[model samples]
Target: MSLPFLILYFYLMNFIYNILVHIAYGIIHFLSLFNQKLQLFIKGRKETFKKLSVIQSTDKTIWIHTASLGEFEQGRPIIESLKNTYPTHKIIVTFFSPSGYEIRKNYALADVICYLPFDTKKNMQNFVRAIQPELAIIVKYEFWPNLLSQLKKEGIKTILVSGIFREKQLFFKPYGKWMRSFLTAFDHLFVQNENSKKLLNTINYNNVTVSGDTRFDRVYEILQQDNTLDFINEFKYNTYTVVAGSTWKEGEELLVNYINEHASENEKFIIAPHTINSKKINELRNSILKKTILYSERNQVDLKEYQVFIIDTIGLLTKVYSYANAAYVGGGLLTGLHNILEPATFGIPVVFGGNNYTKFQEANDLIRLKGSKAITNQHEFNSIFTTLKQDVNVRTTMGKTCGDYVKNNTGATQLILNYINNLFQ
Candidate 1:
């Protein structure tokens, strides 16, 4: 291409990217008004004003940034470890997405849980001046070019934990020079696998380590906690139960079809969708032929008789899976993959729709081990679910595989915590 055409192409592509992001931000802001949980997100920045004031008064502060609730949870062990190791430093937590800030605004460990402003030069300049963090940690794939560069300029030691990279991502592309600068700002890039480390090395970014994924540790922690859910126990009643978590509409549709055609009269099912929009709840209820209960509306007794139960609330999915014999994970269809680790830790074989899941280590690993299966449509769903249900030995063997996979992946949280401890020492 000629020089003028190349310049025009770059300008247009940049323009489109900015426009799309801005439009998405506006839509998120608009949507936050109607939902109570979402309103908490819209008001997250305002809510952090008091916390920021407190931090401003403190002498030493450590700043941790996470993109969403998943990242927040993944970084929880590290945050707790930091607080325990260095009790004197104030922890300032920031989120680029409202989903992260809204869920964790009231976290007692964090002095502040604010929405990070758009990563503009002025925003980073002002934010860095105000917070003045002694140390900075970013969870997962949250690299903002201006913010990272500003942190480096301020002599703040920036670290990335539980990070992952793939061959297809922008950083690996030929014209990714500008994007690669963000990766370079990290003092240490603690990635999930050797693949991520290799990709970073290709960009001449050598300050990296393979720390594995902290989420495995997080889910294992959940397993060690008391696994008691009275309602789920009554519904399960020593029967084989399938817990389908974080299901999107596409996955749910396929599940309903499979249940209609093949699910035995004795077996039970539990569904926790990614989002519990009332419309989605009703749609799922309408689609299924068997007796069903919405977790929000049903009493404990109501769920016991139903073959399927739809979880309409958040925060209960991990606990609900404790009673499951098998689990069908959600997010693979349209959105992304939900927490396969939560169910896998319980030693339950998992199922899900397939797409956009190169980042999920446990899911990919489980498939390779034959403890998890991915389906493209109703036909595949029926085949997988039918075989697992009818064959007891296969079910038990796969369940064992699921448990073992989780056991081996433990200690990422500890590895990260050890790194943080070494820094202060």
Candidate 2:
């Protein structure tokens, strides 16, 4: 194709992309009228630009972008490490999802925490002009074309950390030529594995490095922290404990049934549901036949009296995993899986429903290492549960495998940091 025609093609593609983004924005705005979460999403973006207006342009800024809270966790170690190493540079964090922004808006490490503006060219231009970041680090797979292209045009150095690419992704498809062009915007991509690096290489994109996943580093660091929970200590009391983190309805049902049918006098279960809604909490409480105690109401009742403990709060799941002999990380039976690494870092044999976990390479890696199990139904759950409970040698072996998996995957953050340091020097 001629240079002029190729330029025209690029412009036309961008124009269509902007139109689709605007249409999606309109739909979200309409949905905001009925959905409280969507309302907060819209409200948060408005507040974000307002917050950005006051940020001084004189300060050297490092902008980190994450899709949600999970990606935030992946990027967090890097953020802290960068802040410590370069104390003069102001670290700014932006979230594409409302959940991440709402939860971590008050994060101490970030000088500014806000929602990323819509991916329109104008919004991208305005945001880049306001922030004027020296380096932009996008976590995981959030690839916003307009923002990236604008950053590239302005000569702002951008890199993607903890990036994973699969063979089936749109970037490799015939119709994905336009999307693939966005990959060129990045100065470097610090990917999660060799498979991702190879996938990028197939497209002749050599500016890639296999830095592993930062989540492993984050979980390992969590393990090093003081994870003492007084109530958990009292509740366990030397019992063989099963900590089920981030349970959904399907996972909870299976767990409740297993507890009702098979729980022994010396066995205990701790369930922390994904949502702490009163209705869902009550539903979970009533479903279990055993004496179940809510985390909030535990102080009023004797902890040892309950065989099933329902965690009715947030931010304690990782710490709660420290008290487990085995763990069931949930959400696999529903949409996807939650963090199995949190429990795995504690050296516990982890279990979850076998559904959609292909994107999470660690989940599959854990299975291969005999550190975790993916159950299809109650029968599989029972078998796995029984074995982990009865066979001490098996459990110990699996637990060690889990710990080793995490330990082996460490230092991705340091690798990424070293590259970033070189960029500055």
Candidate 3:
């Protein structure tokens, strides 16, 4: 309100904007080096309005934003819902990262898919003005202050879908006063759990609902599709299989160590590491004393000769779980957590690192149902794996428990669709 305070506020805002602009500049350079296509790809999005002028669409669009590939996967069910429910509505999708945009740019449901321009005030204003969406849905944890403020200024009906929150986050921190303003910009937030709702309530932003997670819906859909891999089928024949899906180095180390020490004659192991780079694959092979086969180099695989089959590829981890008797979803052992719902949908028991049960709701549910276990070290891993392997009855029971957990948590997509329809109606 006062002249001095107003000037100070403006100065701080400008300073922050400059920092973001520099960060954006660095990101642009980084993306350009690895792939020229990515460079040319995002160069166009920097001025999306000029590009969109050629499309000649007079209809209002429903815009959705996702941070990366995982969020896009979570939002896939919502996209399918929109197609079935509101066939006439035009849809636009945007991603902030190359990992998201690159993977799903060819998505059939979305009318347009591109990188969301940097969150500069001008870019946000230009984007909002060009698209003029009737409704906007933001997925997961991505929040850009400039974009949110601009959307609020334009009176857009914005909502956060499959939302999550944690106490350690800046929004709940006492000193995060300026950061808290971003939460108020949303008209509604469809949170995944009670923890998120409580966190939002603490900030006086209570337009929130507990809608569960949409990824369960997506993973369930995968099971309905044809899941037979010709090469994989020959490899998993009539053997007690332990699938390590989305594994990192830490997980692989733990698993390799356990398998080497125990040496079960009836059991076979499959590993799908998160990074399938040649160096990493070779390292994994060298780590194991057993004869290992890489998926990339060979076509047909024999299950009997080589007990360990290393999946040195991507996009096959989820499908491979269909053939698994038990699975270990990776990421928690190191730093990040992998997708647990993928393995659970196949009705297989899952194991992971102890650090991950915090953010993963399905992991918690499976643990409650006695379908999954979280182990901190090799001893616990050996004990849990051995128990599940030896006793077929225990494996069958735990598998049922995991399947029930997935079945119970399947309606988040429907709830989100209902909320969106009510707003339009």
| Per-model CA lDDT versus the true structure | 0.81, 0.91, 0.82
lDDT of 3 by residue, 133-250 (tens): 8899999878888788889989999999999888988888876766787777798999999989998898888899999898989998887999988777777668889999878888
lDDT of 3 at 279: 89
Name the regions of candidate 1 deviating beyond 4 angstroms.
Answer: 1-43, 46-51, 300-302
Per-candidate count of clashing residue pairs (backbone under 3 Å): 1, 0, 0
How does residue 157 of candidate 2 score in lDDT? 93
As a whole number from 0 to 100, the lDDT of residue 215 in candidate 2 is 95
Candidate 2, lDDT over the whole model? 0.91
The numbered model that scores best in TM-score is 2
Q: Which ten residues in a row have the lowest lDDT in candidate 1?
A: 48-57
What's the ranking of the predictions by lDDT, best on top?
2, 3, 1
**Highest lDDT: which candidate?**
2
lDDT of 1 at 315: 79
Worst 10 residues of 3 by lDDT: 48-57
| Residue-level lDDT for 332 in candidate 3 | 84
What tens-digit string does per-residue lDDT give for candidate 1 at 1-425? Answer: 68798778766765665577668657877998787776665576555445566655456889888888888888888888788888888888888666566557789997667887666566678788778987798999877766887998888878999998999988889887557756767889899999999998988888888989988888888877998988887777788888898888888888898788788888889998887689878988999998888887676455677898889887798899898888998888778887788898988788877775656887788889998888887788888788888899989999999999988988888877777777877
Clashes by residue pair, model 1: 331-336
